[model samples]
Structure formats: C-alpha cells, structure tokens
Target: MTIPYGYAKGTVISAPSLKPTRRDHETQYHLHFSVQVADEVWDVAVNVGTNDSDDLLKYKLVFDYRHPLIQTLQASPAGKNDLTDVNALPALDFVRSDLLGTTGRWRDSAVMDGSDTPEPVASLTRLIEKALSEKFDVYVFGRFYSEGNGIHDAHMNQGSKGRYIHRPNSDQNDHNAVWQDGAVLIDCRQPEWAAYFAAFEQQYLPTDDLGNPTPSSSPIS
Candidate 1:
C-alpha cells in the first residue's frame, strides 16, 4: 500500500536458491537479502543495530508482495487487471493473485491466516532466509509500523500482554525460548485500496443511479 508520503520505489529481486529451516517437525523456505531503494541499500551494514536485519527483510518482502510489477507478472488470464474494468469480482481475483501466487489456490488457506501452520510459514520463512543469505536486494520504502501499537492496544484492552521471561545468554533457553517479536496486522476493515476507495466513494458508493452520497448500511469491508 502507498503511504501518505512519497517514498522511493524499489525492486525486490530474489536469489536463485532457497534455504530451509526445521521447525515443528517441518522444513520451510527462508530467503536472505538486502533492500535497495533510491540508490541506498538499507539494513545491510554488518551489526547495524538491534532488529535492523529483521526489519529490513520484513520490509522488503512485504513491499515485494505489494509491488505492481510483481502483480502484473503473476496475473492470470481470468484474473488480469483488464478484467477488473468489466467485473469487480475479477478485480478481487486479481488482487488475490497479486498477494498469493498462481500456486496458492486454496481459499482460506492456512498461510493467509498468519498462523503457525506448518506448510505456509515454513515456505515463507525459508524463502525469506534464503533471500537474505543470497544477498538479493529488494527495493523498499517507508518505516515499518512500530511494534508498540499492538502492545499499547493490548494493555488498554486489559489483556494479558504476556511477559518476556526468557533469560538471555542462558543455555537453558534455546532460540525458540525467546518470544517472537513482530506481529503482522492486516487492517482491511475499510477500503484499503486507497485509489479504488477514493473512486468508489466519489462515484458509485454514494449513488442509486445518479451521483449522490446517500446513507446506506452497505458494509465497505
């Protein structure tokens, strides 16, 4: 998604190889890489800072998935952007194809849920790790949304915000003992396709036949 501010655009080029990790008795894809945007390579300096490596990788992957070029590359015959001009459902299919490749056919797939499902997570993680290792750079822009938002929200809701109890530098605590640090929240409650939403709000959503903003209970989500 484009941010409110203008940011440099970059390409997310992948390496020719993949890396695998064993977790929960399954193997997955991890891609290793840097990010290139506006002639600058982000998060590539050795020992840059805490969370820098992770942040760079995540940013690259997310933008890569959202890139229009990549979307065009993956568009299917029934799901191309042109089809959207005549059919809204076809447009939705195009969006789905953009996010999930041709191979991702199952509706409500485990990977889409952002859960610890073996196949999806493993596949993604391995792709990411491998990309990182191969040093393929993806062009990315904008700062990643901070982790504090979820934590603050959880605290406000009076939910148990969980503890960071794993002792650092202790042999008793393996890497798995540490808490996973990031959360991916997909906020599609409103029309998140900014351009499309703007057009719909101005023209179609408000009218019966002629142009008007009439009150209706129709859900945009």
Candidate 2:
C-alpha cells in the first residue's frame, strides 16, 4: 500500500456525509477538506468508532495538543511532510490496536450511533456534526484509491497488517508494525480536537472486494 503521512489543516470542503450504519460495508462519515500542507483537497473519513454496532465509543473533545509525545512527533524530521515516508508521524507506536481491548483508544471520542444516538454517543455526534466548516489540523495517514479517499489508520501504525516492501517492491509480507505504518494527530482551533485514532480488526474481517481476507492463504483466518 502506498500510504501518505502528514499534517494538514483547512476549511471543510463539504458537509460530511455518512454511510448509514450497517452490519457490513463498514459504515463511515466522510468529508472533503482543503489542506494547507499539500495544497490539496483531501477526504477525511471517520469509522463508526465501535467494535460493532452494539458498542458505544468513548469520545472526548480535547481542547489542547500539548502531549509531550505528540509534540515530539511534530518535531521529528519526518513529522511535517513526506507523503510516502513510512517513518513519518502518520503512524504512532503508543496506541493499542486490538479490536476490543478495554484500554484500546480507537473506540474513544467518536459518535457511533445514528440520528438516534444516546448519551455520550448522542452528545459526541452533535459535537462532530456541528464542527462542519470549522478549521482544524489533523495528523493524517491514508492510501490513494480511485473512489473517494478515507482516513484509514489515523492513529498508531503498529499491529495492523499493511503493505511492505522487503526488497523494493518484490514480495508481500505481514508488516503489522511501526516501520511500515503511519500515525496522526488532530487538533482543532476550538483548541479542541476530534482525534481519529484507529485499530485493525480480527484477521477474519472482509478486507477485499474479491471476497478475500488480507494476507490470508489459509481458510480466511
């Protein structure tokens, strides 16, 4: 996979569109933004933010981005730019990538419910939905596709299977670690941010349109 990692901020290019909750097809809420860094308009998508439809994510709107580690990442040589740099800040090493680890951060700070979200989900959804057209800076990691672009793996880079070039594009390997990964951080001028941390699911997930689980030569995990 040719992944790009970088930081960008700009105006919302359009109202975020949602993909309606579903048991399949990976529900999402996506929008386009004019990023200042690349001088390009990019689509940013956030997943349902739950292990499943029945789960409620822990969503928090942080008003600051002064975490020492985050600052360190921004200060790294590869932090600001470099689209395809595997070592860029697009992927992080600190997040837990399990599907449902209680300590996992993926399920945090996002609205997962629909027009009837409840409690924290309700409130969180309102916050995100209302942030449209607002300017915000995001640590982004994504791949290029012919269709609409997405904000995939906007968090820690390790533990998730992805592309690996062992010898300059020769073979395929399970590169589920930091080296071939990308990480990001989202800080809003609200000084508040809707951090888009991510994690990969169980190996049995539907990862391909050809009806094949990724890296699976066995019986689909």
Over 1-221, each residue of candidate 2 has an lDDT whose tens digit, in order, gives 33444443333445544444443444533322333334556665544354243333333333343444455434544223445554433333332222122222333434444433533335433544455445444455543333543444343333323242122344333233332333334545534444443433432232232212346432211
Off by more than 4 A, model 2: 1-4, 20-39, 50-65, 69-80, 88-91, 95-134, 144-151, 155-157, 160-184, 190-194, 200-221
RMSD after Cα superposition, model 1? 17.8
Worst 10-residue lDDT window, candidate 2: 95-104
Off by over 4 Å in 1: 1-104, 107-117, 139-221
For candidate 2, what is the TM-score?
Answer: 0.50
Q: lDDT values of the candidates?
A: 0.23, 0.39
Clashing pairs in 2: 58-108, 58-109, 59-109, 60-109, 90-182, 90-183, 91-182, 91-183, 139-185
Compared with the true structure, the alpha-carbon lDDT of candidate 2 equals 0.39
